[model samples]
Target: MIIIIAGIGRIGYTLAKSLCDKGHDIVLIDSDKEICNKVSAEIDALIIHGDCTKTKTLEEAGIEDADIYIAVTGKEEVNLMSSLLAKSYGVDKTIARISEIEYKDVFERLGVDVVVSPELIAANYIEKLIDRPGILDLTIIGRGEAEILEFIIPEKSKVAYKKIKDLGRPQDYLIIAIYEGSELKIPSGDIELKPGDRVLVLVKKDAVDIIRKMFLE
Candidate 1:
């Protein structure tokens, strides 16, 4: 998928890296030319130094061909304009990050496909979304008290060959399911986790380090 990201802020950059690592074609836009140059050498993506809210800049970023356009700048107004411009160019999906919670309805009413609020979501660039390789995805819930995580079991994981019930997991975290190849299996007590399998877990945020020590270390 061809994804164009505007802003290059913390969430924007992290999202770009995550998508790029997943083998997607990515084009990044930022007004700061220095950061553009710095990011070019670090990630496998096209870096465009320009204001994403402008028509010429969006055109230069090839917005029409973008499968998804995301605006995650600190300024909600810029994000709004950039995503609207991308939608006008016929981009199928558009996502915007906004700090102001009240504007979410307005953004959606104005044709933005998805509106994300940093305060409401556990994905507030909070934790390991791109902080580690095997940890595929993460979401914080209960106001940072708990987290939902999707992690691929590493080959060197301590409990890879162990049964779900045999691991002596703490009460705070639960192994929700195991994904093997294309199939999803409920984590039965007898189900032995495999190295290549992906596991979805819900854990207390404070106890995540223990979960990592077992599955990601």
Candidate 2:
């Protein structure tokens, strides 16, 4: 994929590195010359120093042929303008990093392909640490209507000694994977649940409270 990224801050730099490592064609643009020089020296992608919201600068970054354009600058207006400009230049997809809590609906209504809020993402991650410390991580999908969660089995869990299929998990929920130490295994009907195992389960969002009461309580 040909990806054009605007901004060279921590999030942008890390994203560029990870995507480049996956073998994507990347073009990184930032107005700061020093940061551009540093990032260009470290990554194999093309790095340009320019205002991302400007058409000429975006042209220099090859936005006309880009498959994806991402704006991660700290300023919400700049990010939005960059993404909108990329879209105008025929980029197939555009994503913008947003900071304001109230502008999300407006961004979606304006047809931004994706909007990521660092604050919201960080808050959600922290919530996992406090609400379900036993879970490694959790993802809410379909507008928070469903979720996939990772949980470690405690010694006293009621299902610890039961067979996987005999745990009485609701029909709408499913245990997808099990991690025993470093090994990850797919759960099967006959597989026996054990203490010290980590499990990933998919469930409806509304059913989470019920599931937690039955298993974690």
Best by TM-score: 2
Please give, for residues 84-106, the per-residue lDDT of candidate 2 as tens digits. Answer: 88888888888999888688878
lDDT of 1: 0.87
**Per-model lDDT:** 0.87, 0.86
The TM-score of predicted model 2 comes to 0.92
Model 1 agreement with the true structure over 1-217: per-residue lDDT tens digits:
9999998878878999999999999999999999999999988999999989899999999988999999988899999998999999999999999887899999999999999886666545544665545667887676678888888888898888998878866586998878999999988889999989989899998788778777877
Q: What is residue 59's positional error in candidate 2, in angstroms?
A: 0.6
Best by lDDT: 1
Per-model TM-score, in order, reads 0.62, 0.92
Root-mean-square deviation of Cα positions for candidate 2 versus the true structure, in angstroms: 1.7
